[model samples]
Target chain A: MIKQLILIGLLGILFGVFFVSMQDIQELYNTFGKDYIAATGFADTGSRNLVTAILLDYRLFDSLFEAGILLIAVSGVIWISKHESQEKNAQFMLDKFKTPDLFVTFSRLVYPLMLAFGFYVIINGHVSPGGGFQGGAIIATAILILYYIDADKDTNIALIVTIEKILYIAILLVASLSLVSRGELFTNFFVIDASPDTKAIYLVLLNVMIGMKVALGLWTIFTAFLKEGR
Target chain B: MNPLLTFVVILIGFYGLSTSSNIIKSVFCVTIIESGVILLFLNLGNLDGGVIPIIGDALPVGGIADPLPQALMITTIVIGSTVTALALMLCIKVFHHYGTVEWAEILSRESGK
Candidate 1:
């Protein structure tokens, strides 16, 4: 009881600081908090979507590390949850349930649409609100739908892993090529001071690679969890 | 433009975290906090009377909200959800091992070792 009280008191104090700090924050538009980069975002990045420009072009390094973090976390989960009972339980799960035809039909109907929409989002990341992460998540959901349709059959995990590796390596290759071209990494090498067509192509390529890597990585993680139980 | 609402939500999340002993509830509290923080960030970027920051001939140059915070929040939301999912997975593993997910019970079981 004492410990709980202490926790509450500590939280109250912390929130008090937040409440006090909020008062000082004026409306962002009236103050100097204007997004100055957004003013020239299209000129600099050739992306109509300012958020995508900030994400892929300005802060590409951070996004790469975020993807890496997800990889590490999923790997950790797979590593820690290993047990003999889990294998048996997963096998039991496979043997117990029959796939409903309705679910199968529904998934078949919607899965292709989701896949196409995901690709469209990744392809048009620069032109629209959707980007690599969002598109990848959608594709991952589509993979999840595929999983639901046929849980008994195991897809080629090795192939997915290989594709994920190739995509990551491609991203690295692009980054290194940019480094070589401009003496700095992720320099928007083809975008800045380049023609319109190549700039659009470069951004699209980056977004596509990131999208594929993210989708494959997430699908692998989900399957790893599904294959094991506990 | 009011940050007070988001702050209140964050405080509620903190309170939930402080009170909860269940691992699942803890995950929920963390998610609530993450959502509150995201809301706060989106609010920070929003102008008092502004539009989305998409650029085109139809959209005006001025009155656009800050794009940086919204962009950062996008990645932040993804990362937060992934972390919460993993945490819940770990909690399941713990529950399977110890037959309980309450922190006090888990602690007692570990201490018995």
Candidate 2:
């Protein structure tokens, strides 16, 4: 009871402080007209969605490094769980257990739809709220569902690693190309045309690449854990 | 945008972090705190009367929510989820080595060893 009271008191104090500090602040949207970026973003980056414009065009470097951070963390997990001798063989474990009929039926029905939605999100990222990271995480969920249905199925870790590496290098190359063409990294280079549609295409392509890379990276980490567990 | 609610949510997470003896629970509390932070950031972008931050000819003209904070929050959310997953993996490894997830038990065992 005392602990609960202390917790409540702490939360109340924090809430009060936040409430007082926020009282005078104005919402930016009211003061800024349309949006800070909405005025120029469509013409500048060819993305209808201002958020996507900021993410893929204006602040691409941050996301590039975000992907890098995921890569490094996955690498760390793989390294930490490298001792395979003690771990029970994942394939053997898989062979021993029978998949439930209901789960199998459900997964089979939902898998294709989930995969399609993830890809759709990636493709339409520039035009909508979904983007590479969101789409990638969704795609990873599809893989995770599959893993849940069948623990024994060998996830092609080698293939995923190869694809992830290719995508990383490709992203870097695109950034370098942007540096060469625009004299600055991650600039919206395709905005030279009268219509910004061409630039939107570039953003979409980047989204797809990032999505696929993230999907594969997450799958790798997940499968690594599964294998280590058994 | 009532920031007080966000603060309360964050404080709850912090309270869980401080009180939890289980390593896994602490990791989840970290995720909870991250979610609260994300909510607070997205709230900052909202207006009383605003349209979605999409530009098109046919759409109604009005104030649009700030896109920058929402975009940054999306990135932060992804990073936070991945970090949480990594933390869980660490907890699993710790449990494997120490044979217990409770901090008290792990510490006692370590000192005894």
> Against the true structure, whose DockQ is highest?
2
Residues forming the 10-long window of minimal summed lDDT in candidate 2 chain A: A27-36
TM-scores of the candidates in the order shown: 0.89, 0.90
Per-residue alpha-carbon lDDT of model 1 for B27-93, expressed as tens digits?
Answer: 8999999999999888877736577778884556455787888888887866776676688678878
Interface RMSD of each: 2.2, 2.2
Q: List, for all models, the DockQ compared with the true complex.
A: 0.60, 0.64
Residue B35, model 2: lDDT of 88
Q: Write the per-residue lDDT of candidate 1 for residues A115-137, one digit (tens) a residue.
A: 99999999999887898888999
lDDT of each: 0.77, 0.79
Report fnat, model 2.
0.67
In candidate 2, position B86 carries an lDDT of 80
Q: Give the share of true interchain contacts found in each model.
A: 0.61, 0.67
lDDT of 1 at A122: 94
